[model samples]
Target chain A: MQNLRIPGPTPCPEEVLKAMGQQMINHRGPEMAAIMKEVAEKLKYFFQTKNDVLVLTGSGTGGLEAAAVNFLSPGDTVLSVSIGVFGERFAKIASIFGAKIIALNFEQGKAADPALVKKALTEHPEIKAVLVTHNETSTGITNDLKPLASVIKGAGKLLLVDAISSLSSINLPVDEWGCDVVVSGSQKGWMVPPGLAFISVSPEAWKANAESKMPRFYWDLAKHKASIEKGQTPWTPCVSVIVALHTALIMMEKEGMQNIFKRHQKIADFTRKGVKELGLTLLAEEKYASNTVTAIVATEGLDVKKLLKIMREEYNTVLAGGQGPLEGKIFRIGHLGWVTENDIKVTLDNLKLALPKAGFRS
Target chain B: MQNLRIPGPTPCPEEVLKAMGQQMINHRGPEMAAIMKEVAEKLKYFFQTKNDVLVLTGSGTGGLEAAAVNFLSPGDTVLSVSIGVFGERFAKIASIFGAKIIALNFEQGKAADPALVKKALTEHPEIKAVLVTHNETSTGITNDLKPLASVIKGAGKLLLVDAISSLSSINLPVDEWGCDVVVSGSQKGWMVPPGLAFISVSPEAWKANAESKMPRFYWDLAKHKASIEKGQTPWTPCVSVIVALHTALIMMEKEGMQNIFKRHQKIADFTRKGVKELGLTLLAEEKYASNTVTAIVATEGLDVKKLLKIMREEYNTVLAGGQGPLEGKIFRIGHLGWVTENDIKVTLDNLKLALPKAGFRS
Candidate 1:
């Protein structure tokens, strides 16, 4: 199989994959009750939160929308911090749901500045909510959420986070950070396939849900929470994926979350050093580089797409090219979720050989 | 494993289950593009619509919300026809999105009346849309969609269908019936696990997309359809379920749509006959009884929950208890997707033995 290296749909382990193939069981039965309770508990542990972490049968984007719609009403002012594509998406979904957005834009490859976020919030004191991306996958940047969360929470505003690509791969102590609503997906560092997404909602967020008036049904967190209390979901879930997630969570628990974070950090460091060996510049600055994925600025005179194509076709290693404005300017190497040291080495080896063919000279 | 006879999450075959366990892949890569395109084509075949059927990473409820939000704007006048719980959900979601609902209520256990629907539309001349469920799983009544479709079409109003439990098991030709938006899910006759939902949007619906004023983001059909044209979803999909769906669809094709429909019909007939032989009354009127799920009135003096518990604990069979107002009054037997003569016989055999134990003498 090719080394399928994408920021979100990372490789799942064989055991977890096998678990997904298990037959579908009664979703509203006794077994499901046990599974759901265990899953919610483990998810809380992974998120480092005493709050409820609810699972929804949708993608990460769906989870983001849940956080947005559940806590903020239509026309509620939101100070949105954007660093890249996924970061900007938080603001976009909120805006579509009628939240008045005060977008505090940052450079593509740079992390969000806490000072700038503070300035924006201060200027727009009416902004009831603060939206930030903990990990910007498009740019491979992980924001320093601790300080940002302090600013938002200290101001007594609701702090919502998009942790889709960061949660399990990095150290994100959600409750310690005072994040009111934290959203995540299964595909990034969960060692599972894409489908199910989760969001941790605090008591303050539930209060917001009581007052929020934006039009919603499927992404309604209130419905999901009530059903969870009853050991059911508001709707039929993707049972197979949830079971797979249960399996993946078991393995993750055995590995220990701290050790998982440390492994990712080490692999990310190795990948960055290897990319620098090829004379390629990192898109994200050193301190803020994401452990789940490493973004490299394409070498001068190199077609990023061609570089990826060459690696995929010749070396059976698939890498993601840049999205949006960064297209053809950067390529991302995912080293999360069941990735080994050898996997990173294989990707770098392919890049070293393919860069020369893409007309790069070093 | 018990015979899981839920209306939607029916038992899946072994091959489809095995396919779900397959390894993950690069969703943005060429292989996914091919798989997505093929799935879309096959979905169109199953939906019997030349129109684009968008696949979403959510449940059947999400698909229903998509139909409501994508077509009718907030405060638009909608004539919502309801027979039971699932039917009322259509109106409920639309109402949540701020649609002005003109609820035309029907008796439970009976199909929607075409003449009544026509009269309601005629009486409410300003009705811009009509909402109906093709199969009301709550009461196990399958509405005759052809006449209802004719009435809605003749009135030149958008006809949104919640075909969650009906589409593949029973035939309701989408294009021929002029269903502006027809929605379904993965857990039904597709013989796959829940996690994804499908919606076929007609050209008229796309025109509605231009004028829709309801707040929406994740349930946006336009975004889903635009991405599907490029062989992708707007968000990360349930990859494992999609692959399993691909496998299930292959088996379905080998059996052929006509034969699949016949099998469901025969199973429904056998299940209903078995219930009758046991001196149980069917909840749905004979003419409109659903071929996918059979709702039977609980035997006299029997506790529905106790009956279900007895079936599950003692007989190793799980049957759905009544929902909504039918709770404690009726129970349902599901026979859709991969069900055979043996499966039906087993469920009936268990029911026959368990009824007396639950205080019903039959």
Candidate 2:
């Protein structure tokens, strides 16, 4: 019953949750269209894009798939920069689409070199798109998408960014940043439950959709665009989530995007400072740290499982451990969405008490 | 607003709606796993299939795509029987995956003939799968899936049924009817909000998945199955909808599946008899009438639009118009899910008054 401190499904505001609990409406009705139109406009404002924003009913991974399937064709070469688990997921998903994947793997907690991505594009002029995860949630590292976008723009290829965990918390100018396609989810910084995923597609990406041949139907961008033009989706959407998203977007607008971003930065900085005061080593480089979450490396052979268990059972706080190869080596504390400085302080306080119980000297 | 009485997105039970309003939870946590396990088990009972049922965070169309992309490879042949709008969607989606489609077209108000499907399959032995809509909401026609299953079984090809509007309201024995893949949605007979799509896959469908060359990531059946084995999903699901589904399934079990189907049939029969008594003509033949919804043709040139408008504004009843080619030609009355005999009687009473206002002779 305690607050959700782990990355998303972050703690949604009571008003937003209650908005979803409202009576269900007919999806094809005009009432639903009003909500959809309002949410779509507000999302465009948040994404900083003049182009259409299409909402799909799925997770962040679904948004990633939509970006790939909508732009790249089978046998097309795609360069993916793998900084952590999500970046690797992008590579895996692209390969599943039969895209010739050219992955630029970096260290676990390090950012990918944009220069390497440029070199890959130079080596393979056949590459149609370069994929990057803007914020690698697994390691709490934020890759410099601007630099990567510069590299991609220089090559005249498309730039696709997975901004799932960093969209609202981080400063992403989809148009000004020269990104072709940016995908985000509702559960992360949007402070909504998991169900809706969105993508802001540039004109160039829309052009790419016409020729892409990776086989798509429900996720087809062209169909989605056509439906959006008429203020509808190709099929029924998650009306409850859409209503919740409309409320969340209105809240975001009232808070101001810049202010929200700065609040996330402040909380993340406070969390990092608090953890350092506890003498713990952060996972990623300070310069490349993400504002949404912070990954902490377990030092002195600490029992991470016991630490996480104590945090959950005793303090009633649920923190996430590293995924895939980094599992048990580190744990993550998410300070995104509705989280505040007090939340960060409380989590740090829990860590202060629970670490020693797990045989860690703090 | 008023209640949703359309075919899909029927009025959700109060408990189910409140369940979706529950606080969000981490999708990867133990609590989520427990809910998912219970949901999967209950779904098996409703589907009458011991086979695993995977839930996707999309609409019913997304579930259909999951079956298409996960089972049939590019250049694979599929026989799609199109009796109404949704059937054509099946063929179109299959073709999007590069499946060689053999569409067997039927009149709008008629059910697809199993003999025709047998003939098509006999002619096209290369067809990897047979796609059919169990209940065509557009035409209010329900195909005899049992006989169609025999044809598909004799052809030794996989059968994929779109039971989105029919499941739980009609008799669909996955094992007895020999359906290899059956797709349903939460908005339909499940009495939940629109978001989650459920699909039951047989071992035979799994075998097809092994060799499927279609590109897929988010709709990967194997990934869902692997995660479901651990009582998890590969990605975050529509958590609120899952909560709603869990609550709805509990209620469904208490009512019992047989009684649920019979209740729908009773409502359908009552509505049909009432419409006939009012001198209205039903769209589909009586033998092939759909239990979920009743489509009534606007005989004697009744203004379908005005009728629907009057019913909505005057009576607060939301009736569905015909889709695709039949648009504005008929009005559909849904009798599925939480719909009762009194609901049907009230709808009939409204139609009797609204018909005259729309300039109908009756």
Candidate 3:
């Protein structure tokens, strides 16, 4: 069997996969309502917020669009604190919906500076909301959201977070951070398939939604809120994935949040240490390194493509290559969701042999 | 096991369900590219169009939103032909996106009138598009799309179709009917789970897309078309559902379109005749009755909820309640997507007994 590892489409546990094969149920019936109620209640525990978390039947990008159009109107001034590709995507979505974005960009593999964000908000007093990514999967960097949230919320700006790749694996504490809206996907730390996106809406975000003028229907949070109150989704949801998510959540609850975090922390540490022992440079600084995925700088004269190929074909292991400008310059190892130290050990052992084969010698 | 007989979230074959449990593959890798190419080619056979059919990762309603937001600009005049709840929902989505709508509605449980649609287009000379549903699952009626398409296409108006429930089971030759845009769901006749929506876009629709001014990003078909050309979705799709769909499509191709249509026709006939023999009345007229779902009017003096309860609790058969105004007045029995004559017979047999227990002697 292949050790399938990517950032978001992480491998699911056998039980979670089996749960996805359960027969379809009536989405509007009492049974479905019961599932909805259970999933909704359990979701709050991960979000760490008392806000109503509504489930949408699309990918994480769809959830980001919902975060944008539901709270910010055309010509609304917004500050986007982008650290990597996903952070930039959040801003791009807002811009596409006509939000006048003031982009505050950090380096490719660095976290957003809260001081710069504060300065941007101070300079642009007209900014209505601040968009940030809790984890930048593209560069394997997690932002320091507590300080950033304090800066944005202190300015009374609505804080929208793209927690797609970070939520369940990392501790976000949405309520404590005063995030107005937080978006996440199921395929990441939930150990579920990629069909559902969860969004938590605070009261301030709902106030923004009422006056927001961007045209929307499918991603409208108000409709979801009204429907979810009665234990239903406004649209027909991805039923099987939701069922699988229920199983994953129950397992997660059993394991407890602190254990889940410690597990990811340990695996991420092992991966980083293994790469360093191989004499490779890490992409992100250790302070901002993400606990879900690890990125390593491609060694000089090493064909990253060949290394990845050898890993996939010869080792039965799959890893992610850098995206966009970082392509061929770095490779990513995903250690999130259902991953263990043994999986990381096998990958590192195979990589040790494959590196030299790909012209990397130390 | 519960018999899920809703119009959507239809029951899948065991193999298809097993396919959904396959381990995750890299969505951007060569393996996923192969699945995308195969599923894309097979989907054209179902859509019956040379147009590029893009698979989205949301429910059918999201597909409808894509069809409208991609082709129609805000302030654009559009004629919406409504026969049921879903038809009205199409218009509602358009209106929500700021399209000026001229509604031409038919009676409940009836199909759209081609003459009225033509008249409406004539009256509204500025009408840029005509939105209609091929099969109204809410009322169990299938509109005569050929005539409606002829009217709209003859007038040089863009023809957008919601074929969510009738695409594979009932014939909808998109290209032959000159359909500009067609939307469908996987949960219906595709015999897959409820996470994917497929849309076929014609060249003329692409032309309209260039000028569509409604602000959109996630549901933008242009982005989908660009990414699908590279054998990738613009977003992380519901990967498991796509895997399931590949299996479902292969089975469909083996059965052949003619055989699939005939199978649905036989079961629908059996269901209608059985319902009538049980001294019940079908909601839809014979000429426009859908071949997927059969709607029966709740007999007077009998509690429709009680009948549904008896069917569910005693026979383990779950039926669909009516939507909007039809709620409590009609119950729907879905016969699409892996359903058999035996399944319908069992539902009918149970209904015969359920009616008397719910206080209906006849």
Better of 2 and 3 by lDDT: 3
Steric clash pairs (candidate 2):
none
- Relative to the true interface, what fraction of contacts does candidate 2 keep? 0.85
- Largest DockQ belongs to which candidate? 3
Can you write out model 3's per-residue Cα lDDT over B1-362, one digit (the tens) per residue?
A: 78888898899999999999888888887788899989999999999999999999999999999999899888999999999899999999999999999989899988888888888888889999999999999999999999999999999999999999999999999999999999999999999999999999999999999989887888988999999888899899999999999999999999999899999999999989998998889999988999999998987566788888889899899998889999999999999999999998888878878888898868
DockQ values, each candidate: 0.85, 0.82, 0.87
Tens-place lDDT per residue, model 1, A89-122, is 8999999888999989899889988888888878
State the lDDT of candidate 2 residue by residue for A292-330, as single tens digits.
999999997678889888998899888888899999899
TM accuracy, model 1: 0.99
Report how far off residue B47 is in candidate 2 (Å).
Answer: 0.5
Candidate 3 runs further than 4 Å off: none
**Cα distance off (Å), candidate 2, residue B152:** 1.4
CA lDDT for candidate 1:
0.89
Number of the predicted model whose lDDT against the real structure is largest: 3
- Indicate the worst ten consecutive residues by lDDT in candidate 1 chain A: A17-26
lDDT at position B66, candidate 3: 94
Per-residue lDDT over B1-362 for candidate 1, one digit per residue giving the tens place of the 0 to 100 score: 77888897878899988888888777877878888999999999999999999999899999998889888887899999999998888999999989999999899988889999999988889999999999999999999999999999999999999999999889989999999899998998999989989999999989998999987888888888788888888888888888888888889989999999999899999999998999999998999999999998876788889988898889888889888788889989888887898998998888888888899876
Q: Which CAPRI quality tier does the interface of model 2 achieve?
A: high
**Proportion of native contacts kept per candidate:** 0.89, 0.85, 0.89
